[model samples]
Target: MLAKQRYNKILELLDKDGIVHTAELVKLMGVSSETVRKDLEYLDNQGRLSRVHGGAVPVDIGTTPDMPGGYISLQIRNSQHLEQKSAITAKAASMVEEGQIIALDYGSTSQMMALTLKERFHRLTVVTNSIQNALILAENPGITIILTGGVLNRDEYTLVNDFSATLESIHIDIMFMTVTGIDPVVGCTDQRLSEIRIQNQLHQSASRTIVLADSSKFGKASLIKICPFEEIDTIITDGGITPLMEEKIRKTGTRLIIS
Candidate 1:
């Protein structure tokens, strides 16, 4: 496609999705990566789209990236992002379908997601490491909660060590994970290395991996990286996402849902 055609196509995609990926444009326009980058640059320079880490977001989403602090404990995280986490998890929980096996990671956001899952389905088999999540989800008779049988992490209230039992036992339909940080350059990351083993096992076992994080997760790189951003199928976050990170996610073709 010509430059004009590519520009129009990119705008059309942005109109529908609120963001357009550089890689998507490369394929859609049948152009080289350099060509797509130039096209994006042209659009950005014209003030038609806001340039970001990997692609571009609609100029209207306007907000610059904010520097986030280092990792905090569960006590602190619960009080932080209360409303944003609720809204993000609520939207994420909707992706769950009946009779599907769902796996959850340890975090306040994942805990909220487990709670929001209640009454959404008549039958659900949930596997998780969060002790609080297990207790909250147990109230629903429709859900079968499988708390991981492993070492207890008192600080995080999660079980770890041997995750083979959970992974080998069942074929998980969906898995929702929580990370300390996500960056365009470093990808998905976390603070604790101990938790990565179990999470990796979960990711390997599941058919789809959905990351649940608030906008605070953006622009931050944690101590350890669990995996690349592309490894995740979808991200459900709040509106705090900056135009820069939105571009990064779209570049990898991962679905971004800003609540």
Candidate 2:
């Protein structure tokens, strides 16, 4: 594998097991022990993981939006995985029907999905907490945007209010959401606690819940877990997902769609 793929694989392993031994990684990655050590050192320098005695542990990044070197901003995230997210959102948008009441949660991927939906469908009702998503779809006259009213989270560009009551009254045909991580055991997780609750409420309100995540999210676990894979109706991700990671999610009885 290339250095980038190797780096992602190593991070995924760390997210899955919390720790990784250099010897095991050498075997898993089909590289030399020296190569594994160098990879770990590079990741350690990037603050992605903590290098230790003959091994490394996953770092607690993406937990807070304000912490320096820890938080991943929306702009940075939206710019990072452009091609992968484009494919994922295109596939996600194709799954939606015209005039269906859709719920979009706050995230970079969801914003991309909103853009896709606006271009593809002429008539639809979209309920979202993302200020950016609402603004993106507002340009389309045929689409009706419902901004979930709440405390505006400036950093994330999301509304952070209790959505339990609002969602209870509305029926959502489908909800496309994003996650910070997707550890096989931990299922779906995010960095913010408020978003986690809102995501859960949206999941309950929607007739179908489809998670929009790229391959990088697999095997990782964030600060707050939303639900297990079984609870999610489907997961739409890019082709970068590893076979092992795909198998793990499939075993949870959640349908996996590779974009």
Candidate 3:
């Protein structure tokens, strides 16, 4: 196929599946791997998509104003951290117990926790803003999943809206939340205001709040602040977190667990 035609097909596949692996693109376009790489490079340079390891993800121009809400779009842009996210998830899961009610946030790390919980927990109630996490837990008879009703973010597959206000009235045993950035001084931050509202509400409603993040998320602040580190009960992260950063978090009297 012509270069233009091949690139168009690549976009079509990504639009259909939300992600496209380099090998799949090569097969579908009947092109050399180098040709596929160059095509992805060109598209990424144009700011049409973001390149991830072994694949490409569609960019969320909609989040930039003059564009629709792009929560899902941004989530896809950061989907390359699957390995580190899973480690955070495993560590978070170890903190849960049977018969406990928990609130799970909407993020890649939280999704990993849901998957891990499905395999281990026998009797638990899970409330979540993530559609993907809810669906994964739905199949497990050991867990009862409650999905917050509100606006559906197609890109991230999460729900956000006035339903968050309802969370304030109900009590949860624990909340496993995720953030875009964590600074020793600025605390936890997120890119979207809507997400911040929901996360804050979840934190207030739960007896114990645990922030699940990877080392990459540290030292970066986004557009909005969710809550201060002192408000959190604990932080679960990978060992990649810097000692200086960990010291900062520990000083807040919040337990820090490195997996």
Candidate 4:
């Protein structure tokens, strides 16, 4: 196949699945790995796609109007652990009670939490920056949803920037946060500085901070550290979390709830 045909086909696959791994593309195109890599590089340069660790994702997804300087679109081309994220969210939502005010972070994991909570809880106030989360709760009359006002991040469907500073004025019973990476030593982290600032404020203002993450997040480090493990009041994860990891987290004196 011509290079142009192969490139267009790759994009077609990405549009259908939201991601295209290098190995998969190589096998599909019956081409060398180097050739696949070159195609991905070419697509990225053309602003047609964004290359991730092992794959390429669409660039326009979750793009914001007022994007900060040097801000690249954030997309998860690989959704390998989505099931695990749902499990973790389900377990975390079970901990919430009616009439409690909760602060929810943006991301797929927290989105699952919002969905679970919508079915389980009634008469609660939920504050979140995620447009998806807000819409999920909007259908329920028993839940009062508050969305943070800020520049909308289309990539993640969350609000960020100076408007996040407003979180400091409000009090919440619990904060359910999700991060791109979590280190037993370095704590929670995200790729964007604006997100880090908002997470920090939420951590400080909430009475309790609970981190909801899957095993894939463990040991990875992002560009910015939002909070240390000690600052986290509780961690809810799936059974895929290793025993050693649980021990390391426990040593920090943070409650670990494994589902």
Provide the clash count, candidate 4. Answer: 3
Model 3 Cα lDDT, one tens digit per residue, 14-86 = 7865666787788877888999999999999988787765677778533343122233354554465677778
Q: Tell me which residue pairs clash in candidate 1.
A: none
Candidates in order, TM-scores: namely 0.71, 0.76, 0.73, 0.73
Clashes by residue pair, model 3: 72-155, 72-156
lDDT of 4 at 95: 79
Task: Give all candidate RMSDs, comma-separated.
Answer: 12.4, 6.1, 8.3, 5.5
**Candidate 2 structure quality by residue, lDDT tens digits, 1-259:** 9999999999987766456778779999899999999999999999998776667765653334423224555665676678999999998888899999999998788988889998999999998888899999998999998877788888888887674467778899998979988988988988776677678778888999999999888887767878888778889999899898888888888899998
Largest lDDT belongs to which candidate? 2
Q: Give the 10-residue window scoring lowest on summed lDDT in candidate 1.
A: 62-71
Instruction: List model 1 lDDT by residue over 68-173, tens digit each.
Output: 2222457646767889999998888788888899999998888788778874667899988788889888889889988777888877889888754747667899
Q: Over the full model, what C-alpha lDDT does candidate 3 score relative to the true structure?
A: 0.80
Give a tens-digit lDDT track for model 4, residues 1-259.
Answer: 8999998999898776666778778888899999999999999999998777667767865233332212333344225467787788888888788899999888777777888899998789999888888999987899998888899876777788887666889999999998867887888887666666677777788999999888867766667778887788888888888888888888888888877
Reference-based TM-score, model 2:
0.76
Off by over 4 Å in 1: 1-71, 163-166
State residue 75's C-alpha deviation in candidate 2, in Å. Answer: 1.1
Instruction: Write the number of the candidate with greater lDDT, choosing between 2 and 3.
Output: 2
Candidate 4 deviant stretches above 4 angstroms: 1-80
Clashing pairs in 4: 62-154, 62-155, 63-155
Q: For candidate 4, what is the TM-score?
A: 0.73
On TM-score, the leading prediction is 2
Ranked candidates (TM-score, high to low): 2, 4, 3, 1
